[model samples]
Each structure stands twice: as structure tokens, then as C-alpha cells.
Target: MRFVPLVLAALLLIAGQTAAARPPSAVFLNVVAHQDDDLLFLTPDLSQTLKASVTVYVTSGEGSHPESMTPEDYAEMRQAGERNAYATMAGVANRWDRVALRTGTGTTAELATLRARPSVKLVFLRLHDWSDLHGLWNGEVASGGTVLPTGSPARVEDTYTRDKLTKTLTWLMDHFRPTVIRTQNPAPLSGFYAPDPDNPDHTAVARFTNLAAESYEGKAQVRNYRGYDDAQLPTGLDPALRAERTKAFRAYADVDTNVATLFDDTASYLGWRQTMLNRWPSGVSWTDGADEAYAVLGDEVKRWRRNVFGEWGKPVGLGGSGFAPAVTVARQADGRLRLFSLNRNTFDVVTAVQDRFGDYSGWTSLGNPNGPGGDQTGLPAAGTDAQGRLWFFVRNGGGGVSARQQNADGTFGDWQDMHGWGVQDGLSVVSAGGRLQVFATQCSARLYVTATCSIARLVQGESGFEWDTSVVPGAAATAPTAVAGTDGKAHVYFRATGTAAVLMAVDGVVTDLGNPGGPGEVAATATGEVYARNAAHGISARGASGWRAVGGHTEASPAVVGRGVVSIGVDGRLTQLVH
Candidate 1:
């Protein structure tokens, strides 16, 4: 392994700091397909956190360059561009110290730390771009293949099969221990709005990153960003922020001849620079009961009790395994709290019930009606009817809603397919009177590309559930969260498609709650107070007195527990703030 003298000193200093000070409170990891992907699609957010960020370039980013520029040379050039861009973002000199790293999997990778800001690092796996990733994804690539970038000091030889790539990513996660892992969209828009679709390499990298995250032991929150298709979405950044982002990209453009024109003619790259959208914005699950709050930390369910002073006690873990990070809590007629979650490995709906003494039973699989594959099922949502019967709902494999209700004997009935198509995840089920109301975002096409998307409501009728296809006005971007208000009306909350503005619909009337939006489902309390994640990842609550900032950097939506709000912190711990 080779490292410059300065880099060696920096590494020793970093090691010393690691031994002395506490680990970073927040470490943001950006895993992208190409060198410039983060600058183009994930910037502003990327630049904003330069002090606590590490970006990984999965591919060499050598896309059809001129014959004069060899593939290795092109990869080096791109890496240089990225280094320069990140240096600019860090407000430091354009000098980076390169060090060779051997990942836990025994594969040699390159790590470049900004000379002035060691925390702003860049990792290059230097895998072949496009076809190689696609081949790995399809299992056509053989093991033992080797890729060596131009300036790589060691002979890093690895075939980069799907499993190997995923393992490598997991190894990186273990090394960095990021609080947030951001990647390109695993399921990118195609057909209508995206004629070209996202680069297959982007999708492949994202899928591998997510798989790695799932296999990783740490509690890192995974976020997916839109790739080229983000151009079709409305501009997410304001003018001032856009200007700042452009400066960083321009620094990169200066080093890369391929995108040099972007430096002078900024209009061509404006769409991508001005907009940054998350493929899955919703956060982890937190459910509020009468006196306690339940949150899913990693795969296990944890409960927090409220004391008489309205303060929440430290959480007690409710043991479960192989479950998704999101959970739904429903109250049983006998006052037990039942939790529902999707099985991460099998996509099956799993349930666990809390006993009278607050001890949780072992998780019981509810068997997915959407078949066995993990992708076929979404997170489960649970609610209790006026009759006090518990019902569980999930987005089935067919993009429709499937439900199961508690039987009179306490066991759940067979899964019933509530026929509606193209529904997204993050289903919200609220019970008012004797009926259950299910609100979700049903799109005509893929969410990022869809021109026709709305909040669809499925209301339980005397015969069965009937669908109100367009219950909310305007285009909805996220799955709707509905709560039955004290006025006995179902109040629906969703983020508007183009504006990202939080909107509430009640009795056919729509109210625009100002955009404090980042990405995630809008949450509402039982008493009608609304909460949504703001741009800074903090909670914003709108109550009778209007909107107020609820300070907490959370990984998911805030849960309203009685007079307090509960959120999962960036470190994957549950935090409750009493009003």
C-alpha cells in the first residue's frame, strides 16, 4: 500500500483522534455509480455535510470517451475531478492525499482524504462501468475478474460478482460506520417521463448498496436519490443554494474534459443541479399508544413508557428478528399493543403482541398473500376499528392493498386482496366510527416519472372496501397518512408532487401546509396536530397555534405520542420531545 507523507501524517492524526475523541455524531456516506453523480443529483445535501461525509464512486465512470484517453487515464481524470469538487465544497485547497486501503473482504480500494479536511473523504472501488455492473447484476460475470485504475498502487484483483460487490460495500460500511447511506435510485423511472431512464449502473450500485446495508450490522438509515430522471421533477433547491451547488460542479467540470462545457454553458446541467429528490422519503416507523410509544430500531421493536411528569423513560427492547425497520402498532380490545412489520427476508407480514405485563411475544408470520419474494410486499400498517378488531394492511406485490383482520378467536383471518393497483408503500390506515380508512399514493406510472398521481383512499363499506380514486386534490408525491380527527372526519396528509408542500385534505377541502419538506410521510397526531420532516432533517409540527420547529435530527417521520413527539435519531436511537 502506498501513501504520501502528508497522507500518512493525516492518517496517524485521525487514528489519534479516534482513540481520544468520540466517534462522529453523524457520518453521511454517498455511494454513487459515477464520479460526478453526487455532484449532479445529490449535491446541496452532499455539499452541506462535507465536514461529515464520505462519497464512494462504484464505477470508474469511463463512458465512451475518445480513443486518445485510455480507460485507466479517463478513470483517473474523473477521480481528479471528484477530488477537486469535494475540495471546493470543503472550502479547502484542491489537494488530496491518496492512501490505498484493504477492505475487510481483502479487496484493495483507494481512499482519498482532503489534505485540509480529512473528514471529507472519497473512496473509489474502481470497478468497470456500465456493462460490467449490468453483467454482475445478471450473474453473467465470472468471478476473479480484475480492475485496476491508473494510479492504483496495489494489484487489486476481484471479479466483483453481485455477492462480492455487496460484501465489499458492507465492508466499507463497517469501516466508515455511517449514520446515513445515500445512493442512486434502485427503481428508477422509465417509459413515460424518463425516455432514457436512469443509467443501469446507477440502479445496480443502489441495489447493491441497499443489500449491503441490510446485511450490515450497524443501524445506518438508507436513502435513495433520483438519478438523471430528477430533471423531470420540479427544482428542489432555491436560487442561492443552486448557485452554491453550481460552484462545486463547476470545480469538477474544470478537471473533466468530458463535461467542460458545463462550466460555461450551465443551462444544460441546470435541471439536474436544481433538483434533488429522494426515491423513498419515508422514515422508520414510530407508533404512539395511550401511554407509550413504540419504535422500530433496526429490526427490533422497542417501547418507551411515559411517566406521570409526561417524560419518556429509556426504551425496553421487544425481541424480534429479520423484520423491516418500520412497524405499525394497533391496540387490541383488551388493551394489548400488537405490532406488525414486514419480514425483511421473506416479505411476509409478521406480528407480535405485548402481554398485560408489557412483555412482547415472539414474532408470528402472517404469511404474505403477495407470494414469497421480498419486493412483492411493502411495510405493513395496522389500525383498530370501532368494534376493536385489529386490521393489518400492506401494499401487495401487485401494487394493490391486501388486508387481514383479527378473528373473533384472536387469530388473524386469511389475507384479502383489496383490489386497487399502482399503490406505493407507506400505507396509512385510520379507523373512525365502525369503518377503517386506508390512504395511499396510487400512481399511474413510476412515482418520479408519473404525471398522474393522487392520494387514493379505500374506505371499508358494508359489503367490502370501496376505493375513492382521487380523494385528495392535486398530485400527491408520497403515501398519504390519515388520522380520524376529534371532529369525526378523516384528515389526510401528503406531500404535493411538484412543490413538496405538505397538504391536508378533509371533507373535500384541501389546506396547504407550507413546505418544510425534506422527504418522508407526513405524520398526524390523534388530536389533529400535523408533523413533517423539514429540509434539515428536523421535525416541524403544525398545531392549533400554527407551525413550530420541533428540534431533533431524525431518520424518519415523527410519531405523536400523547402530548409529546417521538423521532428516531440519526444514531438510530429513539428520542421523545414533550411539548
Candidate 2:
């Protein structure tokens, strides 16, 4: 008890102070439900943490792979592996140490319960193993875990409790007192925790994180990072190992999964490369889920994955298939978030209930019996309009030829073939200065933000869809970003090409805000006072003057908040861009 008083208080002070530091801003405590889980959902985040040298705490690696070993032997080997893994991840053991401690349960468990405890300065957290079983990832049936029933997707131990984990976690926090903490979001988990069965560990982690950070209130930020999706890993024992290393990076990096551009590097370049090869001894596994994985991802994207491997023996493939259904995610004029979707043959609004009741579809959409891209136009970018009619920028995907439709009324529109313009992101459909403003990317990879009255073209057969274009002349945009500004102007930025892979921003005035280029899209910001994303840096705005790199770095598309915007970067760290 006396130790608690002294140690806990010290932990809190250190955690708080560490958060306010210059760059390498915050410290982190990772409470992954399983070993490989963090690798899947939290990879980039880890990269960012490592870059900042933030301390990490890991748990659960014993029970998983152990299904293959006796409890005693398995625990010993797994603990050794865990130690090796963390040591490799943090880059040093003098600054990092592995301790056998039970996490969620809080109460001291036997040595077997201890998983990962790093001794980096200014950090404290329980790295207790839920079961080393955390190494095995599952959830997606098509990805193959549906049948392999021996690992973590099958967590069967309750040796711990919320109360137990809380006491210990709180003690760590009181000790570390991190002003900004991280955990997985447990609320409305789509694949599992459906309608609240509540056996999952996320809820526990979130609840605990909430409680632990409560005393700090507005004084702190308890960010919820997405845990891994073992459901998506390629089926391979070595992939399992490699996956852990990836997770370590992403969790530290903090970027969204769908959009992050993975710059491939030799496995050896990462610390885990040599160690994983030495320890796990790759190229061996009981099951082969690669084909099934290829089947799920389809061919084109699989080709992208294949391109990365080159001719590396038997190539892994997710097969060639289009993509899953496109769901509309945008706020409606009626003050509710709606998801309009059509898959298979069903068509309807996706269930938009949010944390209000039970047995609810987190987001269910009925497919359009009329086919996905009905008529000449199919799916549209979900954007809200002036009158609040949600705009759907439908694309045929054959090329830039797409149409616009309104979800409130099933009635659709004709298609507009902007053949050369490959639509980037649906930035905005603002009716600021008379006509509707449309901004997107060109097939040539330049920025294009138009003040067009194209809504009528999609609805009618008229030829004139007022499209005004502004290109950065010769700027070859690797990843383009555009957003509307409160100053009555639209701004566009893109990752530059060739020698200066820098990101550049240009104000799509009826003119120019001048032009400036930088190092990474991770450094650019949207053009004005209204900010949409909290973690985006690759997209920034130059005032009537010049450069202010938005936040640290983010991958999610930027969206303007009412006044201030949450900017997320490739690094996944976020800052508010307050006008």
C-alpha cells in the first residue's frame, strides 16, 4: 500500500510531463488482447512511437502458440520469445525490460502471466499475458482462421477481471500518469462484440483507460487506437512473426489501414527481420491461408501485394476480385450519419444506430437490386450538400466516368465521363460562391478543384457541367489532397514527384496562393482556417502568406470540424488545427 502511494504518484507525474515534450510527444502503453493482434491493427502506430522513442508495454503471448506446447514448457518458451520480441522492438533492453505480470487482472499472476514490461524512462504499465495465445489471430473466415480453432480468437481464460486489471492499470497510470494514453476502441466492434455479447477484451481496456484518464479530464487525451485484425493476416507461421513486427511499427506510426501507402523495405531493414528469422524459423506452418487470402482480396490489389514480393518463390495471392461493397459514410442534413450501400442485390440505407440500443446493426446497407452502378451511374462519393441532401459521387470505375445521386430519393442521374480525371477523394460539395465546388485528382496526378454545376449533368443530359480546373502546372502528385476553405476558396495539395518527393500546396483561388514544396505529404496542410482531420500533415494551407505544416502526420482524409479540425498524419499523431 505504501509502495502504491509513492510509486503511483511518481508514475502519474512522469507520464504527464513526458506528454508535453517537443516532438516525440507522448508515451504509450499497448494492451493488445493477443500477441500478433497489435501487428495487424496497430502497425504504423508503432513506427511513429519508435521514431519518437516512446516506451511500449505488451501483453498476451503465452496462451496462443502454446496450444502446441505443454503449459509449463509453452510459457517458458513464449516468455523467452516475448522478451526477444520486445528487446528487438524498443532497440535496447537497458531502456526496456520484460517482466512477467498479469495485465487486465491487475492482481499479480504467476510468472506465466507476466508478458511484456519495458523499463524505459518515464513509463509504467502492466504487461500481463492474457495467454501467450495472443500470437494467433482470427476473425475473418475467408482469411482461414474460421477453421483453425486453436488460437486466441478462442480466448478461454478468465483468470483476470476488470476490477483486477483496473487496480494494476491505475497503479501504472498513477505511477506513469500519462497525460495522453492509448487503447483500442471497444465500442461497436463490427466483426466481433456484435450487439454487445461482451466477452471481448476491448471494452475492458477502453473502460479502464477511461477510468484511469478520468482524474486528468480535459487535462489529458486517452486516444483509442484500433487493435489488430488477425482476420486479415496471410496464413503462415512466419507471417505470424513478421506480422508482430509490423504491428509494433503501425501502432507506433498511427495511420489508417485502408489508405496507408506501405513503402516496402527489406524485412532485414526492420529490427524484427533477423530475430524473427532466427527464432520462428520461417517457411513452416500447418495451414496455408494464402490462396484463401488471395481469394478474399481479389486479383488487382493482390497484384499490388504480389508486386511487393516480386518472384519470391510461391507467391501469395488474395485472388482477383473487385472490392467489397461501397458504403456511404457522411453526415446528413437531418442530423444523422447515414451509410447508403448496395451489395449482392440488396439496396438500402446502412443501419446508422450509434451506442443507443442493443441487437442493432452497427451499419447495415441493402444492395441495389438494380445493380451497384445502376443506369450509367452507380456509386457516388458520399458528400453532404447545401440543402443537406447527401451527395453520392457515383463511379463506373471503368475510368473517371461517374455520376451523382441523392440517397433521400432513390431516383438517380446520368453519368459524366471525366475520363482523364481519376477522382481522388470527395473533398467537398460546398455551394459557397454560387455554384457547387468539386475538387479531385487528375489521371496525370495533378490537383483539380472545380466550381462546377455538375449536379445537373448527372441528373439531366445537358453537356455543360461547369468544370473549372487548376493544375500545379507540372507537379506530379503522388498522393493528392484537396479541401474547401472558409475563406471562400478551395485548396489542393499533393505529394511531389521525382527528386523532391516533397508535398506541395496551392490555393485554388480563381488564382494562386503561390506554391511551396516540402519533404513529405505528412507535412502539408489543407489551405485554410477550417480543418477537417486531426492527424494529417501531408495536406496543409499557406495563408495569404506561406507554409504551416498541419499536424505531425496522418493518412485519413481531412474533414473540417465545425471550427477546428482534427488533423491526423502518417505518424498517426493528431493535433487540432484551430482557426
Sliding window of 10 residues with minimal summed lDDT for model 2:
277-286
TM-scores for all candidates: the values are: 0.84, 0.39
lDDT per residue for candidate 2 within 291-393, as digits (tens), equals 1111111111111111233221222332222222222345555544443332211222222322333112343343332345332123334554455555544
Each model's lDDT: 0.72, 0.32
Best TM-score among the predictions, by candidate number = 1
Write candidate 1's Cα lDDT for 165-267 as tens digits: 8888887777777878888876654432444567788878877787788766666667677777555444544455567778999888888878885554323
TM-score of 2: 0.39
Show where candidate 2 strays beyond 4 Å: 1-25, 50-59, 66-68, 93-106, 109-159, 185-218, 227-429, 432-482, 485-579
After TM-score superposition, what is the CA distance of residue 102 in candidate 2 from its true location, in Å? 9.8
Residue 576 alpha-carbon offset, candidate 1, angstroms: 2.3
